[model samples]
Target: MIKVKRVYDAPESDDGVRILIDRLWPRGVKKDLVDIWMKDIAPSDELRKWFNHEPEKWEEFKHKYMEELRSNPKVKVLIEVIRRSENVTFLYATKSPYNNAVVLKEYIESLLTK
Candidate 1:
């Protein structure tokens, strides 16, 4: 199973391998909060700045982000990690529920289904 969680949330035992997926370390968050920090798997700086978490731009952001995932070699590394784990959690610092981790979870699920 895959889970998406905010970095600020209290850690749970069922979270499994918690991986932070943000390009930058979130302020006030300690390094020990996550099991792994996969910053490279996050969106590129260009795309992240473009979207800016605007609800209206979500569709376009998702499309461009999917393109990035398709070409990113780091995705294979994430996949390998997921395959080895019974459960995995993606951690992000965004306040919005519709953040990069949500998109990444959806993208990874699609890849796993194939």
Candidate 2:
């Protein structure tokens, strides 16, 4: 199974092979703070700026983000890794708790569950 965690949260054992999915290094976080920084798995700069976490644009954003993920082998590889791994956590810095990774996690889990 895959898990989601915030960077500020203390690392835990269950979050096996923690992967930081943010395109940019989280503000104020040390490079050594997290393991396996999978920056390539994150959305592109263009996509990140486009979404900007606007509630009004979330629905549209989700659609486009998922499409981008599908087209990008880097993002897809992360999902593939999680599907094959016993336990992996997607660590993101967003405070919303409803960022693209939330939806992306669900999509990854669904693929694994199948």
Candidate 3:
């Protein structure tokens, strides 16, 4: 199973194999708290800057980000991790719940179902 969570949230036992999916480290979050930091799997710097968590740009951002994920080799690594673990949690720093973590979780889940 794949889950999305905030980087600031306290770690839980059920949150197996927590992976940090943001391109940059979240402010005030310590390194030890995260299990894996898949920066390469995150959206490109240009895309992230363009989105800026603007609700109006969410749809466009999802489209563009999905395009990026389609070509990203690191996505295979994420898939492998998910395959090896019973549960996986993707952690992100964004205040918006509809950010990259949500998109990534959906994308990964789609792949798993297929």
**Candidate that scores best on lDDT:** 1
Across residues 1-114, which tens digit of lDDT does each residue of candidate 2 receive? 788889878888787878888878888987776767878767778878988887887888778877777777776678667766788888899888558678778767666677
Candidate 3, residues 62-105, lDDT tens digits: the string is: 99999999999998999999999999999999888669998998
> Once superposed on the true structure, which residue ranges of model 3 sit more than 4 Å away at CA?
none
The candidate, 1 or 2, that scores higher on lDDT is 1
Can you give the TM-score per candidate against the true fold? Answer: 0.98, 0.86, 0.97
**Looking at candidate 2, what is the lDDT of residue 92?**
92
lDDT of 2: 0.78
Better of 1 and 3 by lDDT: 1
Q: How much lDDT does each candidate structure score? A: 0.95, 0.78, 0.91
Off by over 4 Å in 1: none
Please estimate how well model 1 matches the true structure, expressed as its whole-model Cα lDDT.
0.95
